[model samples]
Target: FKQAETSFNEALRIDPAFVAASAGKAELLEWQGEYSQGMSLLQPLLAAQTDDPAVLTVYARLLRRTGDAGKGMDVLQPLAESGRVSGAPLRQVRFTLGDLSDQLRRYDEAFCWYKLARQYRPNTFSAAAHRRFIDDLLLRFDSKSTQQLNRSGNNSTQPIFIVGMPRSGTSLTEQILAAHPDVFAAGERSHIGRIVQQIAPLRNPTRAVLARHAHAYLNGLGDSSRAAQRFTDKMPLNFLYLGWIAQLFPKARIVWCRRDPRDTGLSCFTTNFIDPALAFSDELEDIALYSNSCVELMAHWQNTLDLTIFELQYESLVREPESILRELLSVLEL
Candidate 1:
């Protein structure tokens, strides 16, 4: 992060009017939870570059994050409605408008903006391919195969995985766990997904191969992981790899975060995720299809795998955080 900050600063020093550098710095601030600071940094650029899509988008995001959704909407709506922006900027603008509308409880307006945003990006998700992938996962990680594979994996109980559909409180769950001194929050990781891709063609992975993969996963968590009693990987899509997780770390806690499908689908639709794997989120129908597959796969894991999964309901967590968190902590033996 410091390196990034220095680079952005250097870019600005070399060319003070560098819009991209300023915008990138603002984005970095927002990523670091310094929303107000980001807003302040971008404020000067707005007057001169009012129609600049990058500046406007980052500034609007900072506004939204700092609890100024109305201001954000006012700033971005004209550019969006005028249709002056195109390509990635336009898509980002539409998504930001949707976010502002959603924050203001303008559900219909938000949906319209979200739909407009999707029009700029072509949907590339295939339901049949997703179904086939799930089928292959179920076939490869059946109870018998999982049992055979589980015999040789690492027995480390330090790893905790939070998995579910996008926007299903996975982040919230991780945040709560991270509040505990013994738990290190790794945030959303792509290691598991990458590992899955690497081992996809192996019909029968050797015990050494599984061990090596598992070790690589832990090593990827970095040096801070050594200090904490437990570390969390809150990649929502890790739901697809529960069977592999069961085989590799049978003792690791798996918390499945769930929200109302309507809410989940709505949230997924509104947000512009950078991950191409979430291209399924571009359309409501695709979101539903992908969500159903996730539900089915999760149920299969629960019914077949010997592993115990702690189910955390988003609504319940919101309403009764104390009790829910207590139960969750007990389940994790924290």
Candidate 2:
């Protein structure tokens, strides 16, 4: 975080009115959950860069997060309706407006905006290819195949992965676990997926290749992980790469968070992911289909692997946090 702050500061020092620098700093603050500070940073830039899609989107999101949804909606609706932007920026504005409308209980308007957002965004998610890949994965990683799988990496159980569908309590799960003295919170790492993309297609990736990739991932866990007993990688979509995770770190833990499917669907549909990786979340039926696919994949993992894939139900965890926390921590025996 110091590195991020220093970089942003240096950029701003070089040119105080640099919109990119301001937005980057504000985004860093938002990622750290410093909502008010993020809002303060973004508010000034909105006027300066009124048509800057990045600034407008981040500023509006901060406004919404800071309990100023009306203001946020006001800020986004004009740009979204202007038709002055296309591609990703237009999708962002529509999505932000959808989120603000959802918060305001304007469900019909929210749905309209969300649908438009999804339609306008690039079609990066290929359901057919994804299903074929997952099906092949299940076939390839069954009991016998997994037993013979390359177990050539470090055996250290220093990492705990939290994974599930978007809006499935992954963030909450990470927060509670990281609150413990022994746990370090390493927010979403896309490199894990990149590693899986690199290795999953191989007929057999050698041990050296696997070790190098695993080390690269571990290095991204950040400095706090060095002193902590267990660090979390709470990238929800990592559920898609469970086979690689199981193979790479056979002894490490994977915490799979679950929530009511309808609830998760609604939540995901209403929220703006601002990430292409979660393109499935943009559409309701798509998220549902993807969630069901995840269920099938998880069942495969549970039935086939000997790894500790703890299932944390969303409703139960929040309703009985103490009891749930006790049970959760017991898994680590921390």
Q: What is the C-alpha lDDT of each candidate?
A: 0.88, 0.84
Tell me the tens digit of each residue's lDDT in model 1 across 112-156. Answer: 998999998678898899999999888888777766663336889
Clashing pairs in 1: none
lDDT tens readout by residue for model 2, 108-217: 99889878877875667778888898889898888888887786477878889899988899999998888899998889878888888788778667788888887888
Q: TM-score for every candidate vs. truth? A: 0.92, 0.85
RMSD (Cα, Å) of candidate 1?
A: 2.1
Please give the distance, in angstroms, between residue 60's alpha carbon in candidate 2 and its true position after superposition. 4.1
Candidate 1 colliding pairs, count: 0
Winning model by TM-score: 1
| Candidate 1 vs. true structure, TM-score | 0.92
lDDT of 2: 0.84
Q: Single out the weakest 10-residue window by summed lDDT for candidate 2.
A: 42-51
